[model samples]
Target: MALTAYEQGLLAVQRREFAAAREQLESAGDDPRAVLLLGQLAGEGLGEPVDAAKKLSLYERAAELGSAEAAYNLGAAHANEQRYKVSLDWYRRGAELGQSGALRMIGVMYATGQGVEADDVEAERFLLAAAASGDHLASFDLGTLFAYQRQDPVMAAQWFLRAAKEGSAPAWRELELLVPRLRELPAGDTRARTMLGVILAFHLDERDAGAELLEVSVAEGDPEAQRSLAFLLHDNAGLPDDKARAMVLFRTAAEAGDGYGAYNLGVAASDPHEAVRWLRQAAEAGVPESYPQLADRLSELDVDEEALRWYVRGAEDGHKECMFAAACWYRDGFGGPVDLVQALRWYLSLLEVGSGDGIHEAHKIVSKMTDDQIHEAGRLAGQILAADVLVVSRRT
Candidate 1:
């Protein structure tokens, strides 16, 4: 008995024979699974170099064959190209097929009025569906819309908590920032009090009053209050330095899922091994600041590959220092093969975003490249610019 084309293609994919899988899947024609596999192969360049136009065509065909993932891909490809109406149409189709990603995109479209009139009601409906299906970003947007647009801070906080529990760094930041705005509320809002106390103590330089307020908030059993008090006790000259108590509070805050707490613990740990563990935890929790810190430490420890990984994360999040570090790494082949094109790409990216400190280096690299390589680098840079890839992450 011979295997069917779909079955053969699937087996080939599992065996990492992408060329064979593409051939078999292409032969299977309109079979939904085959169409989807072929589209994915083209989109991801598994068998051949990526062909965006071919990938889009294949995805559209698969979508016509009723593949939800293909429909979602069509939406995403169109959205990336700023064809919002077409993207929204595809998103609606995928949403009809119960694709969570499609639902999320639809919600975003409605929220932002990309292709349709702004409709908060529709946005909420779709976002809620996506969130229920485990879309963390959808939940985050719901929190933002509720807080800012609907003026429902309590509901916004609730949604933000949902997003944070799902490991959303933006949602965590939103919740923290929302604290001070709640100050006008009754005094029973311990979280607000705790946050205000910390801000006053650490940020505004009202030390004595801040410490007093923090004590009251900590007494109310707020983990953030515990963390803030720990910072003050450790850093303030006027306050007694209680190392053991500070350590306990830091651990407590970290266990409560505060990335700052984890970061502080990572920085303060006497043992390098322990520090690495804490730093990794903080990085995984999406604290952008922690990426460079961990990368620097890893570089000091001679773990070049791990350090490069963290540097890449920081660079992706638009940290200038990390961007320069990553460019140097790519240029020198540190932790990986040297690729002049990739190095040039990073340098050009910095310049495109108005970081002229890299301009001289980029010019030097351009001089070293063949005209063809320079042209290719320029094309790559164009893609990055169109995609708005240079902006800082929510750390902004």
Candidate 2:
């Protein structure tokens, strides 16, 4: 006799056999939870091949059947596959269905252009919606975006405080970095003083004299306080190293899509593999700083292709070091065939962006060329620089 569907599912899970579980779950008919599980397993490759197409289908099916988890998974899978439009569709669907995960994912996708064109306006809209839905991750993302992207320090601090209360490590880290600056604004800034006291008690390696301050702030839904306390407990920097606590805090921050927290966790990891994994997560979340760091690390490992890719990404994001690196690569043919013209183009672009070192270095490289080569390269560089200047000015 055929195994009962429940028995098969249970056995598959017990044996770490996700494929079999998926097969049985699908065959068992319209159980939304089972379908969602199947989609997750297939999509994540817990068993079976990492089949994006199949995973998308399963997630879509389960989502249509009213599984919020399925919809969220579908959006993530679509983004993973670089199907940004489809990802947006699923994310919007799940957000409308009140799935916090999907709402946060939508905000991230919009912020980073995972599946759709990057649009800060859309990102803020989705993130605010998710925050209103009581999603901690959304609150964290909103805080960071306002702080860094919008340069609205006040709003950023407010959001960070909110996320910290929810136990977000990144929020705490950000608070630690920002509190000193906030203190300089003016007197009568009770919010800044109170927040600082709580943070100091939780993280300053001082006696816990103001521990109750942290407790009160956390209880009041101040995300920064929660994050600071969590970071202090997890890192044990002033206490003791608690890997378990660190893992929990890191996971919470990562799930909230906090780039800095993810990047920090990656850096603290034991090996390059884990570092790259977390760095990629942070990079995908729109941390432009991650691109150059990842590129440098990968270059050190001689992973030239990946390094070059990240270097280019960093350059596109206005990282001067990355542009210099790329220019060097093109000139030296590190990862591909040498292309003098490309090298010249990159160097001149750097110069246009007011890089003195880049201009001096570029002059040295071009000086070695024949007269005709120099003229041609100069003409091309001029054109590209003009175009870049126009683009930058438009954005500004």
Highest lDDT against the true fold, candidate: 1
Candidate 2 per-residue lDDT over residues 1-396, each given as its tens digit: 233474456456656766677678877788776776777677777877787677778888889988887887777767777888888888888887779878888888878877678888988998998887768788889988887778765667778877887789889788777666765755454455446655566545453644445445545544444445555566455545555665555656665677766776666777887788888898887777789878777877788888888887887666888888988897898877786666766676676568755655665565455434443444455533332233234345
Candidate 1, residue 197: the lDDT equals 74
| TM-score against truth, every candidate | 0.55, 0.45
lDDT comparing candidate 1 with the true structure:
0.77
Over 4 Å off, model 2: 1-12, 15-23, 44-50, 112-125, 132-134, 188-190, 205-396
Evaluate all candidate structures by whole-model CA lDDT and list the values in order: 0.77, 0.70
Runs of candidate 1 with Cα error greater than 4 angstroms are: 1-221, 232-235, 238-247, 269-271, 383-396
lDDT of 1 by residue, 176-245 (tens): 6766676666788776576567556754577787788878877787777888888878874554457667
lDDT of 2 at 94: 88
- Alpha-carbon lDDT of model 2: 0.70
